[model samples]
Target: MLAASNRLAGAIAFGLALTLGAGLGAVARGDHVVVHRVGASAPAPTPSATPKPTPTADRSGTVSQQRVRHIAEREGFAFLRPPGRNGEVSRWDPCVPIHYVVDVEIGPPTAAADIAWAIAQVSKATGMRFVDDGTTAEQPDDRRKDVRHTKSGWRWAPVLIALVPDSVFHGKGLHADKDSLAYTDPAIYSDEAGDAEIVTAQVVVDADDITDGGHEDPGALGPTLLHEFGHLAGLDHVHRSGEIMQPDGGGVVSYGPGDLAGLHYVGRAHGCVADAALPTDSDDFPR
Candidate 1:
């Protein structure tokens, strides 16, 4: 029994010695312990990534056709529309072409005040003298009171600058059967009219506001007038945005250089007698 107790005491002593040795080792390694934090915000958790905004179509502002026309005329391009035509056009006429006699009836013409302002802008930019043949700032309803009839056709002057309020765009007002279209000579450009007799009348369709890129009118004011003038100048819409003859008017302001070049070519070279019979063939108008 004494021998068994001695063995147990030795074992206990050995355990105590091992424990003491471990404590000594820990003491020797003082300040060597590494502490790690693992809390929710221990290192200031990064913010979740924010989502980016999706891209959208531009729907910001509106533009005026008159402003566009002013830009064209300012750039030394004479903007003329035949009495009644659709689409837009720019031309430089050396002589009064048969088409020049036509007056494009711009619906919703501008108010008197606006008209004067537009004329002033045109005069300043174009440096061409504009003769006002009509009265000032009359309501669009009374526009017919100032109409003057001519031998070749009727002349309505003082370009309508203001658009009618809440005016919706109908199609071109010109047709063979429409009586309101008084200047309906089948010979749009013929041998009868002298070169100097062809006169262009500018008409503005007054509307409450101009349309935007999305809700554009096919026969709006500036576009309509320009288109008619192209016809008067013996050119048709080329379906090219660069050309003023383009039917679909959008964000563009004036005829590109190509259009001006074409205008010079057609106005000086192509005459009503020679080019009148050709069908309106151009692939360059606005689609």
Candidate 2:
């Protein structure tokens, strides 16, 4: 089920689902500028009759554990999901490398380089590593799975970053307006202990807004890409000036001091999440 709210400048929508014994669920929200919240529920998937293998930890502890230099200005940053009573906010497992793929079918010529630049900035801020899987034919899906079956075996799905036409948003049950620059949907997993981790996410940009002629121009797509990537990294919109996580992009091409601080808080400096388990095939989503 889904619920939506309207504002003078833009619209916001939310979708919620509950998945029974699997303890899996999702809460989705999106907007052009103004943010709103809504709640709804869906029937859970029936549990598989056959017992499944015990879930194992995916963190390898091989990634370098480097702490980011503390930033003096931290007031401008905020988390999309605020910290729980345990003082931990949802974030990706910093020990594992985040894999991603690009769908450039409708992207500008500079799409590849532009994405790399933005990811590089985020990587520097957070100690999280990202592996580029090059281009993929896969399109964006709001109900994307946490893992995919490959010839080698089952592994976590790669983060998808795509440049699609505005019309594509009209389908896929997405709530963004045709004029919205971009939208990001992150799949998260939480345990009974209240610890949560973002397993995968999707970043979709409006290809129509970024054409070949102005692809290289400043602010054409850089700020928007960074803003959405920040969302993928769990940073939420902040009204403070000069921050890339601003609701309207804030006309800034790079991350501000607060953005850096927030990224570090969710970054590798926090140490590995050894007990974080990757969801199995039977585990239903928004987990």
Give TM-scores for every candidate, taking all chains together and pairing residue i with residue i: 0.33, 0.71
What are the per-residue Cα lDDT tens digits for candidate 2 across 88-189? 667889998999999987777778888998899889989999999989999886655555655544456799988887788556666454335577777666
Model 2 lDDT, residue 245, Cα: 71
**Tens-digit per-residue lDDT, 136-233, candidate 1:** 44432221221223443323223222233332222243121111111111111111121111223333332323332221333333433333333333
Indicate the TM-score of model 2. Answer: 0.71
lDDT of each: 0.29, 0.60
Please report, as a residue range, the 10-residue window in candidate 2 with the lowest summed lDDT.
8-17
